[model samples]
Target: MTEDHLDIKTPEYVAIQFQIAGLGSRAAAFIIDQALLMIINILAIVILFFVMDGMETSPFFLTESTFPIAVVVIGLFVLNWGYFFFFEFFSGGRTLGKRMVGIRVIQENGHSITLLSSFIRNLVRLIDSLPTAYFLGIIMIFFHPKHKRLGDLVAGTIVVHERKAKKKKKLTPIEKEINLRGLTENDLELDDWTLKSFTAKDWKLVSTYASRFHQLPVEERNQLTKQIADLLLTKKGIEVAGKTDTDLENTLLVLYLVLKDEWEFEL
Candidate 1:
């Protein structure tokens, strides 16, 4: 199956990759959640049935009271409307269906979603569901590159596939031998705007260079390294002089890891 990836630099300055959840997967999750809600409604109905039946035989039976009807309405409202909000807010963005589907809602910036953001997104669900069966949402998701629905767009969130835990790949002998000095914060000549302009894709490119530099053939790696350094550092008005290609590459990677979280940035 084809999957879209979102690369994000985290607070720790490490670049991470997340798989974007597609419309098909989202629809499956929604259906599963709806079925569970339906079961809840059915159980509620059964409970009401027993209560009413007991009331009929009671000496203090009162058919005149509207309390039972009001209770049912409130319960239904909570089930249909509050379910998602409650689950998302409390469960770190996973509802039962989302958990089953291995997807979750998160901010596009690689940070946990705020409570108000969650509330706003869930509130927009009414609009997304308009004209029946999330028709508007489906249309939006179809066109959006990240497959964001109306609520997600409004809330600045995206649904992503949950990352599976895996063992880290062992470093090759050459990879282990690569000794690149880390760039200190003093070395950074970047302004806020330049830093902000560097997107998740840029971070991914930097990270890939750092991780695979030692494994590449020397000539090829040097050429690739020089090209990347020129684009990010020299083009941005950052001074790069007297630094070897290897040094430039390692310095940039170190700078990326060190200052990535210092600036407030978004994708």
Candidate 2:
């Protein structure tokens, strides 16, 4: 199946994209969370009946103490419902399950899930779980283009894969090749006047490209390098016509080196 992507244009005019988490991944996360909640519920039951009610582990133990029964009822409500709300809101859209599954909840605009939105979604989860084992929710997810359930529809939230940007730990072969190119800041031949044209935003663009460079597939890397070269290299009065893919990437790396010292701290 074709993957679904959600794009957000920030107020700063920056664009971000996220991949919608699949049903299998969502189910895994849900199962993990449910398992945890089940364990907690069991523990809570034990404490309410055995510890507080004088070691009476009877199945119908709640009748012994009205106070303990009320507490248990309230605790059940909190554990069953409030767990998702507090965790999704306070934990940056990720519960323990979602974190482990590398998925997270976010608003439609790609912002962090808000408190109200989280509450709304979890509140509607009761309906989603109705008619036996979330049957309605599973059907809704199976049919929905973005795999949204009723709760997600009401809450304006989406489950997306968490993007963890991993910087290169060591100099890979491609990076080594770029480093060996011996193109320093001086190679660009930029003076104060020429340097003044470049901005911190430009540095960010270059640095982002540099960091993600080796991680992309060859075709994407070449295409992206060419695009960046066309967009940015011309400002430095550089020509791109005769350069190989490797040469163009090296030029970008050199540009990143030149801009790093000036704009690194500003951001």
Candidate 3:
């Protein structure tokens, strides 16, 4: 089956739309954070003035005031930016915006976002925000296929939709058998997308159509199956063995095992 027939409920389109919405939400959060920092800075200045007013006779007031004002400015900057970078980089794979918008940053391999990755991603935010107004980042997102901003492209990160609910089901006995069958040349006869890059939706589609394989003419089915087997062998970097159907089945099983192992370890 083609990708279109997989009944994908979470295509890249949906993911990209979610990301665009998330940007707006995140921008709002940044504004709120800045406003809060400004309020704090104002309070600090007012407190500093009162303390100095109370210390009537001190020439040291000027010296002390300079240091405190400098400290307050530096502290505000750190507090304003540091809290977000620390939490987003080292804690959960989200900031307040991401959490609110139901998206998460993850590694390219689909693992949880790591501390180093987070730091690399956020540290480059300044670059992403370059040319004084984040114009570069906006242009990149507008043009790039994945809508990646500068930080995302640099850090090998992407944001995806959080699955809303758990899928509850056990593999059927036959399904379990199929999964365990291992890779064989016959499996290569399946669609390239199915054998090489089956997503969750692809697996569902395969399960739906597998029982109908006999509907095709015998010769046609054989040709398609052989094509799949050849592709599978190529993917495995294995020499093709001219063999019987059973041998082809076994080879397909081996390919399946390899792909399964890679997928599990990646996640």
CA RMSD of all predictions: 13.9, 13.0, 15.2
**Per-model C-alpha lDDT, please?**
0.80, 0.86, 0.59
lDDT of 3 by residue, 1-267 (tens): 111101122434343222232445445545665566678778887987777676556776755656766777788777756665676666566665567666667766556777777778877877877886677777775566555678788888765556566687896543454666643335544555555655544333333334444466767756655666675455545556677665654554454443554354554
Candidate 3 lDDT (Cα, whole model)? Answer: 0.59
Which candidate would rank higher by TM-score, 1 or 3? 1
Decide which is better by TM-score, 1 or 2.
2
lDDT (tens digit, per residue) of candidate 1 on 1-267: 467999999888899999999998899989999999999999888888888777877767685445676798798987788889888878888899999999988999977777987999999999999899899999998889999988998899999999999989985443344333534556666677887777677777776776676678989988887888887778667667788775776667655664456432643
- Candidate 2 lDDT by residue in tens digits, 3-118: 88888899999999899987888999999999999999898888876666573555564565577868788989887898899999999999999999999999999989999899
Which 10-residue window of candidate 1 scores lowest in summed lDDT? 173-182
Instruction: Give the runs in model 1 whose Cα sits over 4 Å from its true position.
Output: 57-59, 168-267
Best by lDDT: 2
Best by TM-score: 2
Q: Model 1: which residue pairs collide?
A: none
Query: Where is model 2 more than 4 Å wrong at Cα?
Result: 52-64, 172-183, 187-267
**Model 3 TM-score on a 0 to 1 scale:** 0.47
Which whole-number lDDT from 0 to 100 does residue 16 have in model 3?
20
Which candidate order results from sorting by lDDT in descending order?
A: 2, 1, 3
Off by over 4 Å in 3: 1-58, 167-267
